[model samples]
Each structure stands twice: as structure tokens, then as C-alpha cells.
Target: MSAIRFDDVWKEYGDHIVLERVTMEVEPRAFIALVGPSGCGKTTLLRMLLGEEQPSRGQILVDGKPLLAEPDADRGVVFQRYSVFPHLTVLQNVMLGREFRDAKFSARLFGAARRAAAADEAMKLLAEVGLAGQESKYPSALSGGMQQRLALAQAIMRGPKILLLDEPFGALDPGIRADIHVLMKRLWNETHLTVVMVTHDLSEAFGLATRVIALERSRNRPEERERYGATVSRDLEIFPRRRAELRSSVQPAPAGTTRSGKEHQPGRPGALVLKEQP
Candidate 1:
């Protein structure tokens, strides 16, 4: 089943049309990069998927069900700006999401024991993002790259199934950006999350995404600009290794196959073979 489906979706604000007839199915565990010129509504599409805005026509489905009107823990988002709370330390920032969720349905606060466990998880998450020893530092104390890392950790702490990124690495230095790219891939591979990122950098899009989606307006003349909206102009699969891995994981394994995708030898318990004979 598709993790997300945008069905003939259209979005308009009074006389302004942002998206028209945008339809696509994003497979589960897919890393999708949405690229387009400035003001072409790439971020608008991301916002709609995040449930911050609704389509003027048609519908959007998540896991084959209509989306809720507002954002939920099932989705996490990071924007161009570092969104960490400046007043809170790194550890506190990451733990804040869980605290809110725990206190959401119940007014009671977590006891000392529960708080300690949550803190430990937050520490581990910060470590994963390469901010291990900076937990005690405030956002102001860190560099721009470190601040962004904190924002990522905060977004990921809730264990969202979908992660939305809007020009997340755009402001970083070239060297830092490359490092973050590697880290981003590691995070995606290690987690079960599907990612949708909007970036203006084509190189970044091509390097990080398993598939690249380009959005463009069909008519760009001054006379008919507002009358038309952007749609998917190009879809490209640029990651051969990732594509092969995804296909293998989703397809059913042959009978008597071992966990390594090799066949188990017949009449020999726990014996494995490279492949089954024809």
C-alpha cells in the first residue's frame, strides 16, 4: 500500500492557484525530493501533506485513509530555520516533544522515574544526530549546523512515520552540508520513516533522494500566470542501489529461503545455500 497518495489535488487561495491536478503515490520508506523554482509551490505541497493546509479540491490519503485536518505525531517537519527552542538546552529540547505527548491526554506530569527514562532516550537520540556531548548546551551556544542537528533530533524524538524537510541544509557550509547528507542517509536507512524534502539545490536533491520530483507551472507567461498552477513535471529514480534494496525488501521471499535471501538446503537442518537449483 502507498504510504501517501495525493489524488487530483488542487490548492487555491482566493485568486491565487498554487497547485493543480497534482496526483502522486509515495511508496512507504521512500525518500522523495521535491524540487522546483522559487514560488512554484513546492513548500506549499509539503505544507498540505503535513496537514497545515487543505486542498481546495480532491483529497489526500495517508495509509489509505483521509488525513486529519491538523498535524499529528505521525508526521515530523523541519524548516530552513533552526527551530529548536533557544531557551531550552539541547537535551531539554529533544525531550520536550515526548513530555507534551505524555501530558496531552492526561494533566498529570511524569514522576521522577519516568522522567529519567525519557531523558535517557533523548540522550541517545541526540547522540545519533552527532550532538552527544552538547546536551547541556543551549541552542545559542552551538553553531548553525549544531542547531540544525538539535532541531532534527527534536523532530525525530516522537518517532514519526513521515519526516518533512524544507530546505534543511541550504544554509550550511559546503563541507558541513556534505556531512549532513551522509548523516541524513544513515538516519533514513536506520529508521522506518518516509521522507519528503523540498530543496532548491538540484545537486542536493539528486544526491539525497531515492527519487526526484520536479514541480513546474505549465504556463509561465505574465498574462496567464495566476490562472495556471504547478504540477509534477519530472519524476526520476536516481538511486539504483536503494531502488534494488526496496524492491527486494517488499517482494515476497521464495519458500525455504534463509534470512540472508539465500535458499535453505533440503534435508539438511539449518543448512544454507547460495541459491536453489532450478
Candidate 2:
């Protein structure tokens, strides 16, 4: 099962603290939305979870193990900017997942038949993500939402346990953003994948996340920020699933029932702060 935890995590850049004493846990299959003002360390948390950044003093755990210092198949990421390679066609980009499943040398040893099988699967995934006929087009030729879909297709090809999104829909237009949201909701429903998203849109965060985490820089003095850092100002549980539903339900936790159930006692303003140490 997929799980994540941050134990007193702190991040610093040459004494400029970005995150401080951030302690949290992400249960398996959790849809977590992090909302905060820009430069409040939301993206930093996502990067840390993705293994692109290291915590200065604390530990990050995945499935109860210390997180590695590099990206891995256990976690997949989609950024605000399109991450697809401009030089590669959509199919090629999606096919990279298959090629990466094995070692470079081992992939070279695969017979043409085996390679073709992998290509066929990639094509299916392309179709699944609505890029069926656009596989031959380069990423530069696709629209913003299509590019996002391509990126998502590539990530899904890996079957990662946890998916991380950093402002994934921030740059898209309203209509495109809504479409992407629907697509993402469907994928999450089908995959039961753990998700942690960083978004500035409060409406999107509340509408999409089972848990809403808000971070803010809490320095009283102007110079304190250089030494101090952003902290979890608010951690609200929007909706928690019941134990019975979690055990029996397989589909994505329904839209409003993300954190529904008798196990979670609702708190102020319909937000249950599971842990308040932040």
C-alpha cells in the first residue's frame, strides 16, 4: 500500500528557510490538496516528496521507509508547465515508460516481438488519455490541455503508487481546466492512486481534495523570514471516508465523500484537523 509521512521536516537554502517543522501524514489513496499563497513552500513540499529536494533536519517516509534522494517509479509527478519532450512525438513520449521498465541494456536485448507488445500497450494508453490519433504529433503541436493529458498518460504508463501534481492545472484556461479535472477524477477513481497536489485555487482545492492543507509564512519580523520559514497554518479534513466504505468501496471515494464516515469526527467548519502539529 502507498503511504507518506513528514516528520518535523525542514528545508533551508543557505539559511533561507523554506519549510519549517512540517509534520504530516498522507494515508494510502488520499487525495490531498495543498493551498497557500505563492512562495509559502507548497511546491517545496511536493518537490521534497518527489525526491527532488532533501529535508534539512527531518525525515520523509514512503511506506514507512526513508525517502530516497532521487525520483522513482513509486511516485510520479506532473508539473504546471508541460513536461513532455518537444523533440519526441506523443507516442514516443508515452512509450518511454515501457523502455524504462527494464534496464537500458536489458531493453536492448528484447526481441522485436516484445518491443512491439510494449508499443501496443502504449498505444492503448494513448487512446485511454484521448490522444488516440494524435500519437504521431509532437508535444509542441498539441494544445495545453492535450499536452497535460500526454504528460498524464506518460505518468500512468509507469503505474506509480503516488502521484504528485504541482499547479498542474494552473496555466490552463477555464474550460480546459474543467476538462482536465474531469479526466483526473476519472483516473483517480480507476487507479485509487495516492495524490498530493499543490494549487493556489481554493475552490479547486476544496472541490478536489479529501484533505486541505494550508501553509503560510509566519514571521512577525521582516527579517525573520530569511531565518524562519513557512509553516502549516491550517490543516483541515474536508471529508473522510467511513471504514466500511473504505473496506468495501473500490471506486474513487465519491466526490463529497472523500473523508466521509463515522471514524472521522467532523471539526470546526466541516474540517477535521487530523494532526495539528504543523
Candidate 3:
């Protein structure tokens, strides 16, 4: 069954349309990586899923229910920037989600015993994400990779069914990015959470995603700008492979073609091309 579904969704900004007639279904526990050139509405689509932006037309459904508002714990997002609280310790940052969920008046009123329990759980999560020994450090003190891990811990602590990532590894160095890729794969395996990631790197998308989606502008001319917007030009499922093997085995998706060396077919479940909005 589809964990998430988009039906003829359109997003516009006054005269400029961002997304048009995007339609797709994300199966439960699917790892999706959305890849496209800059300004292809990749991030816009992720933002809509996060409820940070609303579509101008059509519906976004989660578990068969329409999404009508801002993000809740059901969907957690991690951006390219390390989104940890600067002043708060790593433990506190990870505990914030639980505290907010359990708090009555305010999270600050959460008692010592409750806070301790939350901390214990947070510690386990920190350990899982390779941040166990550094929980006392502030965000500034941690390395870039460590901070991202902390961010991941914070998001995972919420136990979100769907995780949305917008270039979560974009700022890291190659070695660090690779390390994070492994960490992320391990986490995904353990949690079985459905993930949608926006990335510019096609190799990254191919290596990590069970599915790859590419968006592109329907029309490029200045006169046609207002008449067209980005749509899902290509959507294809990727078979699973070890990260080590993925890079060597998979060739980059050629322009106007998918990683599997096939042109997109809208009728196919594995490679779909969405129609433009009216």
C-alpha cells in the first residue's frame, strides 16, 4: 500500500508556477531520492510533504488521509544545515521532541524523573547515530558530521513514520558524506521508515534510494514560463545494492533518460512521467 500519495498536485507562486500536475505514490518503507537540476521544484515538493508549503491545486495524502496543515510528528525533516539548538546540549536537543509531546503547560515543566527517562532514551538514540560520547557537547563544539548525526538523532527521536531530508549531506566533505551514507543506510534498515530525500547528486540518489525521481521544467521560454512549471519528468525504482557496489555498478542517469538507461514511461510504476498542469 502507498504510505504517501500525490494526486495531480500543483504549486504556484502568483505568476510563477513551481510544481504542476505531479502525481506519484510512495510505498511504505520506500527510500526515495528526488534528483533534478536547480529550480526543478525538488525542494518545493519536499517542503510540501513537510507541510511547510501548500499545493495550489490537488491533494497530498498520507495513509489515505488528506494533508491540511503544517508538519507534525508524523513527518520529520532534516535540512542541509545542522538544525540543532545551539545553546542546548545534544541530549537536550534529542529530548526536545519527547518533552513537547509529553508536556502539559510547557516542556519546561517536565519533571526531573520524566526528563531523566527521556534522556536515557535519547542516549540510546545518540549511540545509534554515533553521537553517544558527545551528547554533552554543544552544537558548535561538534564537527560538521557529528552535528548532522545529532540532527538525525533529533529527528529519529520523534519516531516519525516518514522522514523528509533536503540535501542533508550537501555541506559535508566526501569522506564525511560517505560515512553519513552508511549511517543513514543502517538507520533505515533498522527503522523501516519511509524516507524522501532531495539531492542534487545523482550518484547519491542512485546509491541510497530504492526509488529515484527527477523533476524538470515543462517549458523554458520566458513567454512560456507562466504557462508551465516543473513536473516529474522521470520516476524509477532502483534495486538495492551495497554502497560499495552501487558506485561502481550504476552509471549516471543520462540526460532525458533514467539510471536504468530507459526513457520514462508514465504508465509504468517504475518509471513514470507526470503530466503538466492545465
Candidate 4:
């Protein structure tokens, strides 16, 4: 069964059209990235998937059902900005979602003991994300990269089947961005969760996606032209089974830490290398 499907989807903002007649299907357990220039409706499409906006035309389905207004256990999302609460420790932040949304009534009803169990689960998730020992740290105390990892951990704590990432690493430095890339690869491999990411970075899309879908403006034929001129066309190109060799050289090292336990130089030997591969 398709994990997500979009049929002739279109979005408009009053007189302006954002997306036009977009159709696509995301297979179960697949990693797909949507790439396009700014204002090409990438974020708009993501918002549609998240049910933040209803399509002016067409339909979208998640696991063959209509999308929900609020995210559920079946879907998890990570955004560019860190969503961790500054006042809450990492473990508490990660546990909050599941504690409130998933646990049985008995657990939800009980105050202290249930929270303790939730904390345990949160710790396990933190360990999975390589943040085991930092559970007590506040979001403010962690580095930007670490905070992103914590956000990812929190999103996955509910064991969602589909993961949506909207430029989750966009703000990081090149070195830290690479590290997160490696970490994300590891997490995806281990969990096999279907992932759909919206990225402005072509290298990121090429490196991580099993398939890359590029959105472009569509052009109308003479027969279809209207008096106001042919509507702005939007098109998509899909590349499947992207080459792994293109990605092997881009594996990122940990942020702020070097093999010699010293600060890393910007032009260090192992800094990110972008190589073209088919």
C-alpha cells in the first residue's frame, strides 16, 4: 500500500497559485526528498501533508486515509528550528509527546510513576540518538546540532511510521550538517521509517533520498492558453535509486569535536567534500 499519495493537488493564495495539478505517491518504507527553489511550493506541499492547509483541489491520503489536522502516532515531523523546550531537560522534552498522547489511561492517569516510566523511555530514545549521557541537559545548554538531534529523538519517540523533515539541518554549519547527515542515515537504516524531506540543498537531497523529486514550473500548450496567458506551469522530475557512491564521501563528522579531541579548523583535512556521482 502507498504510504502517502497526492492526486492532482493544487494550492492557491487568493489570486496567486502556488502549486498546480501535482500528483505523486510515496511508497511505504521509501526515502523521498522534494527539492525546488524557494517559493516553488515545497513548504506549502509539506504543510498540506501536515494538514496545516487544505488543498484547493485534489486529495491527499496517509496510509490510504485522509490526513489529520494534528500529527498522530502514525506521523512524526522535525522542522528546521529546534522545537525543544528551553526550560525542560532533553529527556523530559522527548517524553512529553508520548506521555500525553500514547500511554494507556492508567499510565496517563497516574502522575508520578507514569512520568518515571516515560522518563525511562525517553532515556532509551536519547541513547538511540547518541545523546544518552546528556539527558539532564537543557536545550539551551546543548549545541545547535545536538538540539536538532534531540528534536529528532522526540519526534521518533512515538514510533511513527512516517517521518517528515523540513530542512531540519538547514541552519547548521557545513561540518555539523554533515555529521547530522550521517546520523540521519544511521537512524533511517535502523528504523526503516518512510521519510519525506523538503530540502533546498541539492547535495542533501542527492545524498539521502532513494528518490529525488524536483518541482519546476509547467508551461501550457497553445490550445490550453488562456487570455491572461498560459497559467504558470509546475512540473516534477523523479530520479530513482540514487547512487550511494555520491554519498559515501559526504559522511559528516561529529560537531565541535575532532579525532584528536581538539577544536576543528574550518579548512581541516576531513571537511565536507562534494563529489558528483551518477
The C-alpha lDDT values of all candidates are 0.81, 0.80, 0.81, 0.70
Compared with the true structure, what per-residue lDDT tens digits does model 3 show for residues 177-266? 999999998877666477999998888999898888999886899898777999998877775422212233224322332223233464
The C-alpha stretches of model 1 lying farther than 4 A from their native spots are 105-109, 239-278
Writing each residue's lDDT as its tens digit, candidate 4 over 92-200 gives 7898787667556632425787677888778877987889899888998888899999999998887787888989999899999998899898777666477889898
What are the models' TM-scores? 0.85, 0.85, 0.85, 0.75
Task: Indicate the TM-score of model 2.
Answer: 0.85
lDDT of 1 by residue, 184-232 (tens): 8877766667899999899999898877899999999997889899998
**So what's the TM-score on candidate 3?**
0.85
Clashing pairs in 2: 239-259, 240-259, 240-260, 241-259, 241-260, 242-260
Model 4, residue 149: distance off in Å is 0.1
lDDT of 2: 0.80
Model 4 segments beyond 4 Å from truth?
102-113, 219-278
**lDDT score, residue 62, model 2?**
83
Residue 108 CA error for candidate 3 (Å)? Answer: 3.3
